[model samples]
Target: MLGLNKTDSKFLLIVILLTLFTPFLMQPFAADSGLDQFNGGYPDLMQKVAIFGIFAVGFNILFGLTGYLSFGHAAFLGMGSYAAVWMFKLLTMNVIPAILLSMIVSGLLAVIIGYISLRRSGIYFSILTLAFAQMCYKMAYSVLTPITNGETGLQLSLSDPRILDGATESTSLPVTNIFGLAMNSSYKLEALNRVFTFNVGFYFCAVIAIIAFYIAIRLFRSPFGMMLRAVKSNQTRMNYMGLNTKPYTLAAFVISGMYAGLAGGLLAAMDPLAGADRMLWTASGEVVIMTILGGAGTLMGPVLGAGVIKYLENIFSKINESVLHSWFHWLPDGLEEVVVWVFARFTGEGWHLTLGLTFMLVVTFLPGGLVEGIKRLKKLTKRGGKPKDKLDAPDPEHTPTPSKHVV
Candidate 1:
């Protein structure tokens, strides 16, 4: 069972199945259907979902388990991207070396940042991390321009020497690959008027995401995870008990950073570009929102949150005024125009409004996030009707005592 109990084993199995069938699941709409715009089976969007899913999963390990919220994780993510791109520029176009160097670079940076930031707790810690991320972002734009390529961003160039790859006769920049297989290579299967694209890049990211999820599951079940939960419950109490929680917290931070690094590296592997904007505070905040919206502490919450947010960003944002007008064309002119205007505010460029509303509703009603909502739905289905009154319901813990002996 891969060191997991029955429940966890089943959960892991479900995750694996979902990852494997993502192409089919995401392309539920027919290619020529009205809902085709909602289809996310394309390579680029699918790769993003898997990549950011890894990012959120990693962030959950630190914030969800240890209660240490960081606002600078994007710094590690950006660092990883830069490291990966440099590897591509100087070493080779192969993704393995780039991914490895990315994790190492980001992990090292996390050590220093965590050491300083973990010295404080709560808001102070958050502010410290945010400052560090902004500093990194600024450095990438100005001071580290030589490395990050400033505003132009670091990208593959034909003039650069790829030592491991040797000399190339082609004038064009090389694409990222594994061995000889190109990352962007894909196969499209047409059936039932639907096109399911099976992309090499998406599969690569999906496999990595599955491994990351498995690792997160193991970490959640381990004794160290318990220690982290204890820290979350009360680090001050653990301190009073003579336990040094710093090392544990620092380790969790570094591990989380490494996960982000892997995510960033994968992004580079898929696109072969690194931009300073990846280190922006907004990018860091996006992961935080993803983690919180999906149920922070739960195993599947982060991934679900990432998928939902990314879906909204990709699909909902594409719904323009023209699309809205088409959908409402059956209505009278005035009514259709009004409806389009109302809907336009929430879709297209204003998709963030929809996301904000969704986040607010989930937080206000289901504080545990989407996972809690799903759990409640499952419970409701099991009940089959309204829940029984507390007085009418038999208590499983308290059974009636036999009084026949006394009689």
Candidate 2:
């Protein structure tokens, strides 16, 4: 189905089901429940999960397949955001043009960056990309202030000429929309003592994310993907075999960058703003962490990693000292204080500490990331059942004879 084998088709179906039910799944806690604060069904965070999922998936295409780590993808992401915002400002509030422009602009930038960066391999390549990203970030903050709006960031203004959208008499800034459907429009469902929000923007992003995942799966199984794997396994060997790996690598890099751009455009579509912070080195590092934590080179790993990180950022970071005290109030005063102090360092403003610890553990124990951990657990479970009877096992007498090798 959809050019995918049975396993991949089933996987894609699972992803679609999960995405379709995201609003319900994310809002597992009822509104009146104590765990309600942990629910991440809000449109904003859901949009982010879908957006960054696209970002991490794209990064995985390059790094996971080609083993070329880029530390500058955030530059493309920012560029996409800037382009989308400009599209909104100069063209229309419609998201189609904004998304299209974002991908094109980012793809062009990726071509130039990839051409230069692909000249080197490994750490040198990573550093070159990082330098380019930092350069772009500085340019946006300084010389390109006219276009980027400097440190204040680029945002929609009332006076701008939205050529395609036509002039409006409204005093407020126009909201981003698809035709007449506002991106922020949402419907709330109240049932079973729970409230679930279905947002237009999140579904839009989710659809795009699903498409991206499908593309990634197809690419992973294609001959081109095989060539990429060859490059990662040994570029020198491929080159010695009369293959020019540069074009393939460059293509992968650009595709990956375009994916980042699409994610950036989605962000702007959700909220019409672009900032230099999006292009920061740390922002680039975050995607790297997401990809690695989810398992590089695996189809669903990046998305899983993105969801986990975003969930931690939104839900776990909300755990404050007061919240901790409330949860631990039953304990002795001294012990509660001690517990809060220890727990505080891993939540709230220190959520990164938790992330850091998780990344360290995953890299140390499950080097293949969360996907590997899951796979191992599955294997363990399968082995945990009652031992197979000797008669139930494959019989050597009935097995086919081994083919003799001619020497």
Candidate 3:
């Protein structure tokens, strides 16, 4: 199905089902229930989930496959956003052109940066990427003020030419759309006095994210992907075997940049604004965190990590003292105060602390991230009552396989 093998097809199916039902899955709390504070079914947060998922997935393709960590990837993402907004300003509010242009511009910028940065390896490469990203941010914020609009950020204005779509008669800016379907349009469902919103923009972003995931899967299973993995395992060995690893690494880097660009375009399509902060080193680091937190080198880890971190930022950050107190009200007065005092440090303004601790735990105890932990748990459950046989298991060192351009 969809040109996917059984495992890939199954994975894709799961993603599709989960995305389609996100509104319900993310908001299980009943209407008017105090616990609704935890519900993340709103369109704004859901759109962010899909956007960041695409960014992390693309980052995984390069970092996961080639083991090349580029700290300036957010530069491409910001470049994409700039290109998308330009398209909207000059051509039309239709998102198809904006998206395509964003990807192309980002890909071009990646080629330039990757070609120069690939000359170095290890920490030097990381530093070089970081420097480039910082430069882009600085320039976008100051030196390139004419194009970036300085600190105010790039925003759609009523004065844009919009040659293809023409200017609106009203002074208000036009909303982004596909044909006549507005990106912000939503269908509201009311049942049992609860309101559920199905947003067109979120669905569009979700569809693109799924397509990106599918492409990542195909890349992971292809011969080129095998070569990239070989490069990761040992580029020196690959060089000794007469393979030019730089070109392959550069190709992967550019592809990943395009993915980031597409994500940036989607963000603009949904919000119609671009900011220099999007190009910041911290933003790039966040994608890195999402990739590693989920599980580096795994297919679905990045997406999972993106969702997890975004949820933390959106949901956990909203908790306040009153809400925390309400939860522990049933406890004795003294005990309740103690509980709230201790737990309060991990919610609201302290959400970042909670995120840091969770990340530390994942790295220290579950190095393979949540997905690998789940697999190990399943394996343990399956082996219930079975005797251990260490010697019968396949030896990692002696495993054999056919290869082309091997490391």
Model 2: CA > 4 A from native: 385-407
Better of 1 and 2 by lDDT: 2
How far out, in Å, is residue 52 in model 2?
Answer: 0.3
lDDT tens per residue, model 2, 103-180: 999999999999999999999999999999999999999999999999999999999999988999999999999988
CA RMSD, predictions in order? 2.7, 4.0, 5.5
lDDT of 1 by residue, 1-407 (tens): 99999999999999999999999999888877798999998998889999999999999999999999999999999999999999999999999999999999999999999999999989999999999999999999999898899999999989889999999999888999999789999998889899889999999999999999999999999999999999999987999999999999999999999999999999999999999999999999999999999999999999999999999999999999999988989999999989999999999999999999999999999999999999877776777755455446877678786568764
How many residue pairs clash (N, CA or C atoms closer than 3 angstroms) in each of the candidate models, in the order given? 0, 0, 0
Evaluated at residue 158, the lDDT of candidate 3 is: 89
Output the worst ten-in-a-row residue range by lDDT, candidate 1. Answer: 383-392
Winner by TM-score:
1
Pairs clashing within candidate 2 = none
Candidate 3 local lDDT, 1-407, one digit each (tens): 87779988998999999999997788888778888888899999999999999999999999999999999999999999999999999999999999999999999999999999999988899999999999999999999999989799999998999999975798788999999799999998877556788999999999999899999999999999999999999988999999999999999999999999999999999999999999999999999999999999999899999999999999989997899998999999999999999888999999999999999999999999877777777766778834255536777789765467858
What is each predicted model's overall lDDT from 0 to 1? 0.95, 0.95, 0.92
Model 2 lDDT at residue 225: 95
